[model samples]
Target: MSTPHDRHLLVVGAGLAGLRAVEGARAAGWAGRITIVGDEPHAPYDRPPLSKAVLAADEPPPVPALRSEEVLETLQVRHLPGVRAEALDTERRMVTTTSGELGYDALIIATGSAATTVPELSGVRGVHVLRRYDDALAVREAMARSREVVIVGAGFIGSEIASAARARGIGVTIVEASERPLERAVGPAAAVRLMQLHADAGVRLLTATTVSGVRSTDVGVDKVELSTGETLAADAVVLGIGARPATAWLRDSGVELDARSGGVLCDSRLATSAPGVWAAGDIACVDGVRSEHWTAAGEQGRVAGANAAGADAGGATEVFAAVPFAWSSWHGHRIQVVGETTAAGEEDHGDGFVLYRRRGAAVGAVGINSPGPMARLRRALTAQTNP
Candidate 1:
């Protein structure tokens, strides 16, 4: 970023965290020239809705973009869409892009992530992922025309896809590796109702099965191979295994990276090993926090942006693991989980989430699916006395 008299901020990615960081810079009195670079052709948009609202729509969702043109005009920033960062020349303080190398006093690596496409699925004529807006559109079109869809994961992504498919009169078969669909998230007990929801909607929930690969036949998608030596024919496949970070550009940037987790190791100040460099969002692996959470991403963006823009970014970042939470909707049921109910614990593992006492006097319940228990449970987390 340049000086206030001659403001200049070069944001690397045009995703949510990138835009927020640039806005933070501008708000901190940046004036010269603000440039945003993105790998996607489209402007910044929210990804959560792509799998739910945008994918079920009749036409490509014009649902009014999440970004405001005034934010750009007010910030006096230039946007360069469809450009990827090739490398980082920290010595020269410049970022090499597809267009050309641009110098920056400070840089934010917010290259969000990409959809993992499976080319190994032979004749998987209409397989798609739900990470990007375009991917959602493609999946929407395929689902509209498909009669049967084989979703490869029973995670939130796969379950949500099955929900959307069932809404459009398309048959959905969810193949999960564990005995329960969301055993890793809500535990087996909580996942029972989720599976029941799918069954109520006539969805074929295939548990304890894994999709080895897919083979194309004369028809659209001929068959899907299972490790169990079972073959199932499908019209389309949606692979929602999981996602990795988009931190490939920082491979040699001297910023300590955790290759296994696909994230950058940030200190308490949100600064990386490199000076004047801060990282956040899914790419940042902060201690005591999991990757890929809306709240965590927002907190990281705020913390890193403040420090990167010369503001007091507070002291050591707190281990803000309030509760490992996630919410999903299927067949009109709103299922919200507040804590990690996915561990191998007994009925009440002290650390695990469960219905328990308020504080001293009485017991306050805590269950992933029941709302009454959740209500009192949240109260207990805040209150010191009995409810």
Candidate 2:
């Protein structure tokens, strides 16, 4: 333990990003005290399997939490669970949480994000959003029953849930406001393929569809009113719409948050506008853009934790570089995408594999239903950075 004036590193949020940050700090030989706080009652566990593997089965994936209290104890890091940060006293270098006030030398904000929901339909029967483990459990319980399941949005989450529901022989209809299910992430060209995959899996997918309001009966969903003035009968509704960063409490904290994206701004070194303060994870919007993604979130947290520990983080020269990536499995087929995939860009590599080039370095690449290309691409990307 360091001296009293040595400045303990206070990390808010106990997700993967936060855990990774603590590890990075310890790796940098920051003998100072390190404490992490989180609002969730559970330890920091893996989230990716919550939707695909955990919810799909009767039992949730046994997530032996990473860098938890035990791991933190080994690293001589403090863990403060069941606390929610309310305000930040940047001038005094102190943070006020529900538990108490903690003065720190540096702070790492990795609050992550929350599920976007239609609160107006809260009293309704069965409207759900997939964000937390409990949300998955509730949705999974509903998925066990065979009823008309109306899924809002055809994004990865929506599609994956639909696939899971379909796997159990549940009826699923995907409602997308856009023409393509995942046009926003993978671009229209690749989204078309995903849409085809949905169709092949017996999923009812409607494009250019808008949900006016959700009205469900006591038993379940009666019908979903559409903007086009049509009603589709449904038993349950799962809203897979995008998520907004949880940063409402940070207002007036003088921390620079993106007005449009709703994410805390940070430099390449992961330092926020406030001195000795940094932000990370989905809640943070580093480099103006690129706020989402598990890998990016973890990487951001690691960099922030390292820099906050008083290391030569290379300042703004440090680049948070990671190929935009996400993987999903549907109907026994696994899909992997790496690099910059857009919803509108026209991609053609003559054989359906996309290769994103910047100054002829192949900055990004996307391949569908092909692990060979993905493995090769991952190797190339890693070699470029590792070498």
Candidate 3:
């Protein structure tokens, strides 16, 4: 192992993945000088709560810090915030940022993704997208003053926003382009239940619909134009259409990227094509698949950091292979999913049963609600060595 004297690790992006990368490097016994660069001004914070707790909260909840102040103090990292990485110079082992250039012995990228928005709604007032704390605050402010809210997507984010809007007695109408909401993620069985849950909660869900355009008044957006030729009055419009990986800065960086996801192409170990470079989080597509789940990002970061640190010290390194898992909350029910439930699977039990979703010979995924089933499947999945 190299002595603590001749090492410097630089992490780009300050999300969960980037934060974990620094922590993982430390845990792997690296005494290098660690530096974290992020475009955002704030420190690392949890994002999942932005769509749920922040929207329906009676009192504005405290900022959700993923790495607490106490935790940050322990990490002992040098943070350069509000500085966007402009380019990467792999040959020189330097990153060109908006502020200046940063050099590194090893690098980890976890730039995450950007919230997708409609170009047609560009420059229109009251059109919002939620992907950051500031976005959540803006949406919360808009929701507080709005009556009719048009959510232009039916994915988990849109559905969660609808639930929160309904909780505040605001009229919510979700316009989904797919034939059924969450058709790609959960298939028809679970999708139907989620649909019913939304209907029961007094939220209007429109499927197989697209927003052709928006009609805005001088003050703000007042209506949403639909491809179905029906225009609905809206006090505000929230775009939850989706997101794209934040890979624009790496376009000319000579790093291999997946055209489909626009994410950094990495091997099973989360190492990119460039030597001494690794990627994690939504920015990384490992083994031809990019996982958008929070847990997967953290795991990938851990592996990337460990490998980067170990390689610098000529020590041991580990591969990352965490089972994909995600959880969603809506209308007071907890929805937990493991692996790829959409894959062809055999049902071990009837509908609403847990510990099912057996694909080929292995249990590919499990969807559960209650504590018992979720606990069992979580433990089983966690113990597995591979995805």
* TM-scores, all models, native as reference: 0.83, 0.90, 0.94
Global lDDT of model 1: 0.68
Candidate 2 lDDT, tens digit per residue, 138-182?
788777764778898888888888888888888888888886567
lDDT of candidates 1 onward, in order = 0.68, 0.77, 0.83
For model 1, residues 159-207, the per-residue Cα lDDT tens digits are: 8898999999998888888776665565555566567778999999887
Q: Counting only residues 3 or more apart in sequence or on different chains, how many pairs clash (N, Cα, C under 3 Å) in candidate 1?
A: 8
Residue range 1-387, candidate 3, lDDT tens digits:
542756889999988899899888888877878999989888887889999989977766777888777888898888898989989988999999999999999999999999998887866898899999888987888888889999989888898888888888899999999887776776566677667778888888888899998888876679899989999998889999888999999987878899888999999888899999999999999989889889998988888988898888889878878877788887777777776666555353434443435534444444535556656666676677554
Off by over 4 Å in 3: 1-3, 59-61, 346-351, 354-362, 365-368
Clashing pairs in 1: 2-8, 6-32, 7-31, 7-32, 7-33, 122-216, 123-216, 355-366
The per-residue C-alpha lDDT of model 2 at residue 305 equals 75
Provide the lowest-lDDT 10-residue window in model 1.
312-321
